[model samples]
Target: MGNVRLRQLVIAAGSLDVADTLADVLGLGEAFLDPGVAEFGLVNRVYGIGDQFLEVVVPTALTAPAGRFLARGGDGGYMAIFQTDDLAGARARADALKFRRVWNIDLPDISASHLHPADVGAAIVSIDEARPAASWRWGGPDWERRAAPGKLTGAVITSAAPEQMAARWGEALGIPAKGGVIRLADATLDFGMGKEERMVKFQVSLPDVGAACIRAARRGLDVVNDEVRIGGVGIVLSG
Candidate 1:
């Protein structure tokens, strides 16, 4: 098996309004509008978050899947993408586990398998591999060094049965979890008990939490210590 890293997390917002809000709060500027995603009746903008990326999709058509997702809540996490050096190995494991992949794409530069959320657990888990190692086509060109206020550090998945979901995810990805926690190269995935299973929160490491909180306050957003809820997700500013 190959080592995997949490490379990107996607949010489904009502519209680009949430993306605009996130750009201000995260100090992120570069946005890649992937034309390919329009086939899904959605508009996608990928922002460079340190070396990783953050993608936000807004449904355009009435029947878009994201539209159904937004109806449940407002805006929230829609998917999680993991970068694996050995995507083939991950796919083989998925087959053994009887995991169903809802979508798949293979290009000259990258290949991705989007697993069915119902089959996996909390959310849509995507395993992808990009050639030339560090090149991320989905994140746009030369985005690795883009400076941002903070970098994503972790994600929290709230599940009815936390340990089981964690184990299920680990099994499908070939990364065994210990007590509902999966450690990656630059971040961690924590599964905690909740009434429902969902991507409830994500962590960002900021150099100046106080300053960021002040900025958020200026925008009339509620900031309780290090966490601020905006763009349909709770951002824990880990200093």
Candidate 2:
């Protein structure tokens, strides 16, 4: 999308232990622990990837939504958030497509709406607009500091009907897919065919994938070729 940017990505795990390993593997420096998420029976930490963010949430209770996702054999790539300049326009498009908002927040600094996963047909999707275009309240203060500046470049979502799912997301975002890839301002979403719908992989643009793979190996992470597994998702390094 011309005006939309890939702002944040989220992962769900069974425990917060993934935080340390992921940080070590990705060279993510400081993390912000948000207490507000406990209200949803979960605990989370947000790591800044430059101005963008990578967050991981683990369920504190068995009945939590993330817990249910894990119970269904899901543990990675929970949500993909995009920052748009016109949230109202996005919501109107979503409404026209019959996509329901499962949760939302409105504040002076930020406004966001999470779409229903069932309707999205893959991973959870959130459309948000941050005031001033660059500020993100969810990533917490001083998130601008980081050890490395790995950018979120793309995400790979698998669905039984990949083309149709991509069409739905593309239409909702006002950026139609080229083939099966929905291109954004800073990232692209690639939809692939799978037995079931889920977010399977994430792509990041880094200075050196070789160095990242070495670090991942030292952390005892599962590194295969140019991809590393953390929090039950494949993090592929490119560029």
Candidate 3:
């Protein structure tokens, strides 16, 4: 099997207005929507943060998956998306492990599989392989140009059974887990034992962390110990 890296992070927002507010607070560029998602009763805004993408989705219908997620966990990190070079190998591994697929898209140019959140023991995990590794259809054509200055380094998942969850993700993705950190080709996943199984924070490196904190403060988000809380998750800043 080839390598895999964290490429996208999806947040489930309580509403469209909250999603928009998050994008603005983070100094993210104007988000673009994928018309294809409307069929799933979801409306989303995708922001390219460096090479990685952050997507915030709200439900159009009360019965939509996004709506159910918001009701269960509120506005927070909903999914972790990984891009791999070997899609078939990944699928085979998942099959061997008997992981259930919640959603899937197989096309000539793109292959995506979303695993059930309950089975993953944290949030939704999405694995995808695009026809040209850099081409992200969900982000549209302008994603690269629209990428902001900051880079998202990794994500933190807090679970009641941290080691077990970490091992599950590590084994499923063929990554190595050490000291609560699962190291990937381009990013890392840190699992922490806590009272909840939720995404707690994301680390971002910017040209000026202080300036970013100031900008966030101006938007009514307080920065405590260089971390800003927004959309029910912490944004940890570093230079």
Candidate 4:
């Protein structure tokens, strides 16, 4: 079986207006509010950065799954969703590794799966696959267009033991470790920042970080202008 590949990262928020504000400020297109595809919830939105996507999720009383995630995660951080060429094979590997499946959702056009934190030695790790029109498009109003000629920079994963955390990500993602980070063609996943009560940070490449921050701040988001760095790995707020 091949190692799981990092596909997308998610951030949970309290409202869609906030998400829309961030999207508009980022000069992202309309990837957020398209209804032709399945709408998970009113507060749930997504923006396509490149091959990978950044999602902003909001809990709704009507949507049990989103509500549950909000209740469990408490605030926000990096909510990872990995992609695999072979779903059954990946599941088999996870099973062999004794990872417990926490949530499983099978829609008409897509199948989403997740593993428990105990299994991955971190927060929830979700897996998904595109099924025809089931997958949503990346460019649209209220969405950030992929930074032309840009790629995913890196993601920060916090763990008590950085070396062990790196190894676990290596094993799960089927990538090799280099300088405490796993580098992919388009992105890097940094592991082992020490476990603490905080958020996971994802450092995405952008043409203009200052502009992004300005846009995010205008949307009533708590924008922190610190150069991207991870200690306990706090929630990533795209500016």
lDDT of 4 at 106: 64
CA-lDDT, candidates in order: 0.85, 0.86, 0.83, 0.57
**Model 3, 50-169: lDDT tens per residue?**
888888887888798878877887888888999999878878888888888878899887899988778777788989999988788878777888877777789999998898899888
Winner by lDDT: 2
Candidate 2 error regions (>4 Å):
none
Taking all chains together, the TM-score of candidate 3 against the true structure is 0.95
Model 3: how far is 16 from its true place, Å? 2.6
lDDT of 3 at 47: 89
- Model 4: how large is the Cα RMSD against the reference? 5.2
Q: Per-candidate RMSD vs. true structure?
A: 1.4, 1.4, 1.4, 5.2
lDDT of 1 by residue, 13-112 (tens): 8879888777777778778889989988999888887778888899997688888878876688889999999888888888888899878888999999
Report the lDDT tens digits of candidate 4 across residue range 1-239.
34455666766666665456545755554455445324455355666765566666665563545555556555456367776555666566667777787767666656666776655665567766545422433334433344332234667777777667666556555566776687764567777565452237766666677766666566555566533222123424333
Q: After superposition, how far is residue 225 of candidate 1 from its true place, in Å?
A: 2.4
Model 1, which residues run further than 4 Å from truth? 145-149
lDDT of 4 at 237: 38
| Candidate 4 wrong stretches, greater than 4 Å | 3-5, 33-42, 61-73, 104-112, 129-150, 176-179, 195-199, 216-239
Q: What is the TM-score (0 to 1) of candidate 2?
A: 0.95
